[model samples]
Target: MNKQPSHASEFLWSTPDAFEETKIAAPGTNLELETGAAAGLYGAAEVGNNVQSVWDIASSPEMGAGEDIVVGQKFSIYRCDALLGQGGMGKVYLAYHTELARPCALKITSPGKLTRGDDLKVRTAEEARSAAALIHPNIVTVHALGEARGRQYIEMELVAGGSLKHLLRREGPLPTLQALRWMSAIASGMDYAHRQGILHRDIKPENILICGRGVPKLADFGLAHRIGRGEYIPRGFVCGTLPYLAPEVIQTGDHSTATDVYALGVSLYYLLTGRLPFYADSLEDFTQQILTAPCPEVRELRPEIPLNVAGLVSRLMAREASNRPSSGTEAWHLLNSVLGQLRDVQSILDEALGYDPTVSWIRCGEKYCVRVQRPDGRQQRVFIESSEHRSDEQLLLIYSVCCPAESSFYETALRMNAEFSHGGLAIREVDGAPHFVMVDTYPRGTVDSEELRKSVHEIAEHADQVEKWLTGEDRN
Candidate 1:
C-alpha cells in the first residue's frame, strides 16, 4: 500500500496529461433541480423571464408594427429597393420613381416609435415642407411629402456620398485645412438658411453630407423652425442633439441662431479631434459637465494644431452663446482671416529645410530632398513630392524614404506597409539593387509646420524600427 501510494504520486506529478480536478461551487450547495418530461407547451407570455414582455403587454393593448416596406415593395409611387438607414422614429430607404425613372431617398414614419398622436406625421410633412422652401446648392432637395396607407413619407434627393460622421468614424481625424474648408462651406449654407429665417437647431456632423465633389451640404433640417416669421417654438421644448446643445438651450430649451453656431463649433471640435469634448454616464452628469466644465484646449489633444485655429474653435465653443461668432458668415470670415496668416505647405517645408536646426531640405525641381540622420548614425535621404490632381480639391504630398531592400525583409516591409497608420514600406528595384522604402502621403495645403515635423519624425522612427527588424537586432 505504501508503494502503491508512492507510484500514484509519481504518476500524478510527473505525467504530461495529468490534471487536478477543480470545483467552483460551494462544497455543500445543492445544484440539482427538478425536471419534467413530455409536458404540454405554454404561451409565450408564460415563459421564463417574462417580466419585460408582461410589462409591454400591460402598457399597450396593441404592439408596434414591423418594417412595412421590403425590397421591391411599392409603398406608393416609389418602389423601395434597399434600406439606407433607420432611426428611432423612421427609416430611410433607397427608392426609385416608377414614372419619372429617378432615384430618391424615401423616409417613412414608424408610427409606434413616435407619439400616439398625429404630431410625428405632421412634423414629418412639415420637415419636407420646410426643406422644400429652400433651393440652395448646398441643401438637399426635397421632391414631395405625402401619406400612404396612414403612414407619412417624404421623397428627397439621394446624396451618393455618405455623411461626415461616416468619414470621421473611418479616419481618426481630418487635416486642419480640410476641416476648415468643410466648416466654411457648412457655415455658408447655414448662413443662407438663417437669412431665409430658418433655424437649423441640429448642426452636428451627422447632419452634414459630403457630395460626390467633396463639397459639404447641410442636411436634416427636420428640426428646423422658421424664426421671426410667426413660428414660435414653445419655451421648455428642447430639440437638438445633446452634445452640441448650447447652455441656454439646455437650461430653458430656447434655441436661436447662436445655438446653431454653438453646435457648429462642437461639430468643428469633433472634426478636429474625432471625439466629443464631454462624455458622461448619465444625462444629469452630461448636462452638468457640458454647462459647467471648462472647455479643453484643442492643442493639448493635437499639439500639431495651430494656436490661432485652436483659439478660434475655442471661442466658437464658448459657454456663453454671445461670446461666439454672431453669424456663420462672420465665422467664415474669421476662419479666412486666420487661414490667410498661415504659411503654405511649400513655404513651410522650405523654411523647415532652410533654418531648422535639426532638419535640412533643398528644392530639387518639383520634389524636395530632405536629409535626415537616423538614430543608428546612418544617413537617410527622404524625397518629398507635392502633386495636384486636376480633379482633387487639395494638393497631395508624398514622402519616400529609401534604403537597401533585402529580399528577406521585403515581405516584412510589405506587411508593415499594409498595417502602418500614416504610410507603408515598399521594395523597389533601383539599378539592379532592391531598395527598401517607406512612403507616406498627406494633403499639402493642410499639413501645418508642426504636423509636417511629426510626420517626418514618425517616418524616421519607423525606418529605424524596420532597419532593426531587418538586422535581427529588434528588441521590441
Candidate 2:
C-alpha cells in the first residue's frame, strides 16, 4: 500500500461546508452549510426559487416532549413530516403532532452521551426547561417527548426554513421592513423570557431562523437559563456565541442582560449590512475585535439608510448598555420607526420598478425610436411600429437590436416579471402585421429603457391627459 500522505496539513474540522466553501466579498466565518446560484448573487437564505410558507402551530406541553434516540443516526417521525437536522451532541428531527399534525423540530439525544459530560448538563437541561418555560411567538416550541427502540428525543415546532445562517447565506441581507419585522419578533420573545426570569445566554444568529422573508424564530436554547438563579451555575467555564458575547463576559466573568443587548446589536448589524462588524482568524481574534474595535457605522455601508435608522443602529451598538432602550416596548417603537422608513424605500423600489398597463395603445411612426446608453458609454437602438395606430384594440411591438444597437428601449419593452403584476404582453402577428413580443428580467442595473419609455410616452400623449397618464402613470 502506498503510504504517502496527500495534503496531510488539511484540518480535520472545518467550517460549514455550504458557506465556508463559497467565496464572498464580506468579512466573517462561513455559517453557510450550502451554496447555490442565488448565494452567488443575492446570498444564501434567499436562494431557493420558491418561497416557503408555514402553518401556525400551537404551543403546548406536548411541544416540550420528545422521544430519545442513539447517536450516529437520524430518526424520522412520520407524524411531523419533517426531517430533523444533525447535531454534535445528538440529532434533532422535525415531527408533527399526532392529533393536530402540527409541525415541530424533534431533537434526538442519546442518554449515553448526556451522562458522559457534566459540563454539558446545565445547558442541555436548560435547553428543554427554559425553552418550554418561555413561551412566545418568536421562540421555537418544544412539544413533547417519546422513546422507542432504545432511543430518546424531544419534539419541537418544525420551523420550515432553516437557521438565519442559512437564510443570510441563501438570501442576501433582507430589506428593512422585513428585517425589523423579524427583529421585533425576536426582541419581543427575548423580552418575554427576560420578564420570566430567563436569558438566552447563547443568543446568536445561528440560533435565529428566517422562516420566510418576514418570519423569524429563535432556536438552540441549550444554553438558556433563569438569569439570577444560575449564580452558582458552575463558575469558571464560559459559554455562548463567541462573536456576540459582551465585554463583561470576558473581563468580569459575569453575564447579564447587557450582554444580550450586545448580541442583539450584532444581529442588527448583520441584517443591515450582510457583513459582520468584526471578523478575525480565530475565536481569540474575534474576542479582540468585539472588545476593542469601534463599532462600524451603518450609514457608511448603506448610505441610503435614513437618519433615524442610522441613529438607532448606532445607539443599539453603543458599546454601553446604558445607551440602549430601557424596555422591549421602547426597542419596538424605535424598530417600528426604522421599519417605516425601510418600508417606504421598498415601496419606492417596487413602484418605480414595476409596470402594468391597463390599456393598450399603438405607435405607428418612425419618430418613436428606442435609444439606450450603458455604463460604458455603449449605445443600443431599436424601432417599433404598427400597421395602424389604434386606441382600444391592443397591439405590442418589441425590438431586440443586436450589437451596437443594444439600447435601453428594447430592454424595458421586452421585460415581463412574473412575481409582480406586469402589463400583459402577447406576441401575435396581426394579419400581416409585425409580432408583439416582450422581454424579461435584466441582469443588473436598470437601463435607460425605462426613462426612454417615459420620454416617448410623454411626447406621444401631449394633448390628451388620458394618454399621458396611461403611458407615464403606471411607470412600473
Candidate 3:
C-alpha cells in the first residue's frame, strides 16, 4: 500500500513518479484537468483514506459504458499494442496503423466520462483540431480524429523518446549546452504556433516530447486558446500545471504569448536545476508565492551557469507579464543571443579568425587549421584541435609546424625550446614525416576569443621564425 499525501493539493502537486501507479484511463479522454474542484475530487473521491492507492476511477473501464481496451485491441485501421502513459485526460496506447503501416499514439476518451453539455468533450476535440492544423517539425503531428464504440479518439505521431519530465527524472539536471539546444528548438516551435494565432496555455516539461534524434516537439494543446478569440473557462477554475503557471494566469485567468514565455522560462529553470522555482505545502501558499514572490536568481543556485543565460531565465520568469518577452519570437531571439555567448570551439574559431582577410581558416574532418601571413610576407599554418584529458577537462590544442625533425636538429631544438617564451618545440608526425612543431594549450572550458587570438598569433610567429632558422625557407 502506498502512503497518501495529506492533502489533495499535495497529491496533485507531487512528483510525476507518485502518479505512475495511478492507472491510466481509457484513450481519447481530455488531457487537461480543471483545477480546484475537479482536482480535489480526483485526489479525495476514489479511495477513503488511501488516496495514493486509489485507482483512477474517471478513466477506468468499469466506470465507462464500453469494455476496457486491452492489448491488441483494434479501433478502425489502428491496432493497440501496449500502454504508453496516462494523465488527467485519459490513457495513451502505442498503436500501429494497418493502412499506413506506421506507428502512432492512440488517445481514446473513456466512455461515460462525457455527459451532455460537458465542456471537456469540446476541449478534447479542440485539442485534436488545434494540433492537426499546425504542421511543424517541432510540434507533434496529429494523424486523425474519429469515434469508436461511442468513444472519441485521436491518432498522433508517436515520439519514441520520452518527455522532458522523464529525462529529468532519469538524468538529473542536463548539461548547459544540451539544455539550451532543446529550449531554443522549443522556442522556435512556440513562435511558429504563436504566429498561427494559437497560444499554448499549458507549457511544461511533461508536455514537451523528445524524439529519437533528441528534437523536442511541443504537445498536448488541450488548454490552447487562439488569440483575439474570446475563450471561456468556468469561473474560479485555472487550467495548467501549477508550478509552470504564469503570475497573470494565476491572478486573473488571462492567457497570452507572454504567459507561454513565462512557462517556457520556468521549464528551462527546471531543466537547469532539477527543481521548480516555487514550492509549498499548500496550494494557497504556492499560488501566493507565484503571485508575489521574486523569482530566485538562477545563478544563485548554479553558480557555473553563464550570467547572461541566468539573466534570460530571470527575464522570462518576471512577476509582471509586461516585463517578459512580448512574444515567442522575442524569446527565441533572446535565447539564440545567449547561445552565442556560451561559445563552443567552432564559435570561438569563427570569432577569432572570421573577420581578418590576412588569415584564412578551413575545417578538415574534425581538425581545424588557420593560415596566417606574417608581416614579412611569410605564411605559416596553425592547427587547432580539441580533446578530453580527463572526464572533467576538455583541452584546446594549438600547434604550428617549424621544420622536419632530424637527429642533428634535436639538441638545437631542445636549446631553442628553452629560449622560446610562449610555446615549446615538439617532434610530431606531419604529412607522414616527423617535424618540430610549436605547441600551446588551453582548457577549452575557459578559453576565450582574446586568448585564442593571442595564442594563434604568437604560435604562428614562433613557428615561422623556427622554420626560417632551420630550413632557411617558407616550408610549413
Candidate 4:
C-alpha cells in the first residue's frame, strides 16, 4: 500500500554448479555421495566458490569457446534466434522449431566450469525429466531434451512476459490482489507437483515465469528432487537461494514439501514488500538470522495489509517447518480464504449495473462513479467509495450531489432529511466547495447486488429531483 524504495535485482541469481551433482533419482532409490566431497555442493554462499552475483553473470559478454550457441544456428531441428539469459548453469535462447515453426525457450547446458563428477548433462536431463513429468497450467511445459554439438539442451514453452524477478524489478511492489492471485495459482501448480512426488527445491521469484495476461508458470527444476528418496543429499549441503532457504534446510541438509512452502512464503513476503524479510552484510550473518531470528511481522511494514494475509505470511515463514502449511494445497486454500474476504467495489458495481442500459460506471483508482439515467430523462452521477469508520468498521459510502450548500437552504435540507426514509442529507465539500449531498451507507462485506441496484437508482432519482427543485438546472 505504501510506495517504498525499489530493491529489485536487475540480474538473476545464477544457479551454481554445487547443485549439479545433487542426486535426483526415482522414488524408493538410495542415492548417496561422500559427505566430504558433497559438503559444499549445496552450500553455494557458504562455500564462497562459484556463487556469482546477478551482475557478474549478466556482464559477461561471451560464453566459453565451444559453449556458445550463435543466433540462427540450427541445432537438432531448432534454430536459435536470440539469447534470453545466461547463468552459471547455461544459456537460454529464444528458438524456433524449423519444421513446425513453433517458438520455444532453448536452454543449453554450460558444462565448462563444473566440478569433477558433476555431470551437468545428466543433471540437465534430470531437470527436464522432473519438470516434464508433471503437466499443469501453472507449470511451464517442457517439450523435449536433446543434444547437438556435444551440448545438452531443453526445449520449453516460451513465456513472453519474462520472470517474476524482472517484473518486480521493473514494476516495484504489485497490488495486493494481483499478488495474491498469482501466489494462489502458483500454489496450485506446486500442489500438483507435490502430489506427483516432486519437490521444486528452488522456488524463488526468478524461477517463476509470467506468461501473457499475468499467468504465472513455475519454471526451473534444476534442483527438483523426488520425495521418499533416502539420503537425497549429503548432510550440510544446502541447495537454494540464500534468502529463501528454509531454516530446516539450512540447519539440516534436508528438502521436503514444507521447505518448498517456506520458500514460497519468503517469495510472498518479497512480493508484498519490495525487499526481503531479513537483511545482513554477509551470507553467514544472513543464514544465522534465518536460523535463529524470528521473521518480522509483515504488517509492521505494510499496516494496511489485511490481518489474515499477514498472518498467513508469518505462518509460511515460520522458523520451524512443522508450523508451516505442510504443502502447497494448504497454502492455496489459505490464500483463497483471504481473497474471499476482500470486497471489490468495482466488481460489485459491475454485477449490479452490467445489464442495465440506463446505467454506466467507470472506476478511478479505488472508487467507482456511476451515471444513472432517471425515468424522467434527467441524469445524475453517483459515487461509491470504501471508507473506514473511527470504530474500524469497513463501510460503503454512496453519495450524489444535489446543489451548493447555502445558508438559506440549510433549514430546508434539514427538513427534507427528516422526511426522507432511505439516505440522509449531508453537506460535503466537492471541488473545494460545500454542497448538499444525498448520502447512504452500507456495510461493505454484506452489501448485495439487489441493495446496490436499489440504492444507486434511489440516490440518483432523489439527487436529480433536489437539483431540479433547488437550482432549476441539470448541473451536478
Candidate topping TM-score? 3
Decoy 2 TM-score against native = 0.55
> Judged by lDDT relative to the true structure, which candidate is superior, 1 or 4?
4
lDDT of 3 by residue, 244-282 (tens): 778777666677899999999999999999888887755
Clashing pairs in 4: 42-238
Which should have the higher TM-score, number 2 or number 4? Answer: 4
Q: What is residue 415's positional error in candidate 3, in angstroms?
A: 58
Top lDDT hit: 3
TM-score of each: 0.59, 0.55, 0.65, 0.62
Clashes of 2: 61
- Give lDDT: candidate 2, residue 422: 26
What residue pairs clash in candidate 1, if any at all? 353-361
Worst 10 residues of 2 by lDDT: 24-33
Name the 10 consecutive residues with the lowest summed lDDT in model 3. 35-44
Model 1 poorest ten-residue lDDT run: 31-40
lDDT of 2 by residue, 33-96 (tens): 1112211122223434222101001111222234444332334443424234432334444455
- Rank order (by lDDT, best first): 3, 4, 1, 2
Stretches of candidate 3 off by over 4 Å are: 1-65, 118-120, 345-476
Kindly indicate the candidate among 3 and 4 with the higher TM-score: 3
lDDT of each: 0.62, 0.47, 0.72, 0.69
- Candidate 3: count of backbone clashes, pairs at least 3 residues apart or interchain: 7
Candidate 4 lDDT, tens digit per residue, 231-307? Answer: 44333335566677787776655778999999899889988886788877544566678888878887888888888
